[model samples]
Target chain A: MSVKLEFNDETLLCKLNGEIDHHTTLPIRLDIDERIESCRPQTVVLDFSNVTFMDSSGIGLVMGRYKVLNELGGTLEVTGLSDNSYKVMRLAGLDRIANIKKGGSKNGNQ
Target chain B: MVINEFKMTVDSRSVNESFTRATVSAFASQLDPTVEEINDIKTAVSEAVTNCIVHGYKNSVGRIYIGVKIHNDGMVIITIRDRGCGIADIKKAREPLFTTLGGDRAGLGFSVMESFMDKISVRSTINKGTTITLYKKISGRAK
Candidate 1:
């Protein structure tokens, strides 16, 4: 499924669920963009607690969102990433660009 | 979807990369697999075919055979078979950062496949052939 979006005054939280492959990203791209545009929150947090898989498409999705939010003078943060997903983000050098919180619990248990 | 089954054999070539991905993605769509599952299967197949062309055939002339089977439950099993120089060390090839012929390769193909698919297995023989099988459990929702 595409990632779910919930927004507060300062934060737009994306509850990412399921695999992040090529087929699934388009919906997310549209959903998140529309939500962010309407809410225009100061901080966007991507919660990957339920994501089980990812690939290059996932990287592209994240990068595209970051660019969009950055242009609007907004900030982006990623939390609750599984270890494997975290590694993929690191490989793409996203750690330097976004705020990635590292203390999230491991996968499968939660 | 009637569980479409397909078999194809093509010469070792790079230009067919996009075509292969498209075909597989289209077939996978029957499962009503989420966009993520579709993309994962495409990426994994692309990587496997690329590996066959590069490492299996050593960038030389050879043939790669692909077989796809779809189940009613929306699971897909793809097997890539190639008769080329087989993997000397399957374990080493699976390492995240290890590459026998290094360049732009992040050595993440196996990892990506493993992460995307529900199961994967590689069988090879020295100077014989290599076969990589991938299984993806897809959702029943019709796309």
Candidate 2:
């Protein structure tokens, strides 16, 4: 799994690639959490454009990040979800916590 | 008539979860399942294998057995078994958002499996093992 992070003044954009499963979730979680905590951005965007596969573990990843941003008074946005990814996230009720922008990149502009 | 049937065994490790899913999806390809169907199966397989690695073996190396059978009627049956710590309460375990691991687990494994597959059943015995069977009907063949 690969995670690329970009930061502006108030928004942190995370681009995730490869498969996100139980084995990879912890490292990805820690990596993103550390950045979010340090940067303390007003908004965090998770880009899933290159995420080929995700399971329930993806739900935990998003939920964990959501909690982190919420505590920091930061918002979380999800983008670039494939149809399958969107279905899994929706089933886990992640769309309720994070703003889901379909077909967009990390910048939230398609 | 049955189109194909196969069984595989893999180490109960987090790294093997993706392998298990990929194997199942490839095995089910004879049925020409739709992209949605393939995703559903892959997701369900991931959950089962992850359960074996996390909850069953608790990070210890163990063995996970998977069996896949596809029928001419366009139905697939998947069986995942692990000989590790068995679930005491299957009912509570199937409940959505109920996880033994507090963090990084949404407790949606079984829930997602139930939602994706047409039918699912779980059988477990303490100190013995657990077996989860999933059944789904594939619709709309790919040309």
What stretches of model 2 exceed 4 Å from their correct place?
A106-110, B141-143
lDDT of 2 by residue, B27-141 (tens): 9988878899999999999998899889888958999999999888888999999999999999999999999999989999999999989999999998888999999899955
In angstroms, the error of model 1 at A37 is 38
Error of 2 at B68 (Å): 0.5
- DockQ (Cα-based) per candidate? 0.06, 0.92
Flag clash pairs in model 1.
A21-B36, A22-B39, A23-B35, A24-B35, A24-B36
Cα miss at A30, model 1 (Å)?
Answer: 33
- Please give the interface root mean square deviation for model 1, in Å: 6.9
DockQ, candidate 2, comes to: 0.92
State the C-alpha lDDT per candidate. Answer: 0.77, 0.90
The deviation in Å at residue B118 for candidate 1 is: 0.8
- Give model 2's TM-score versus the native structure: 0.96
TM-scores of chain A in all candidate models: 0.90, 0.93
Best by DockQ: 2
- Winning model by lDDT: 2
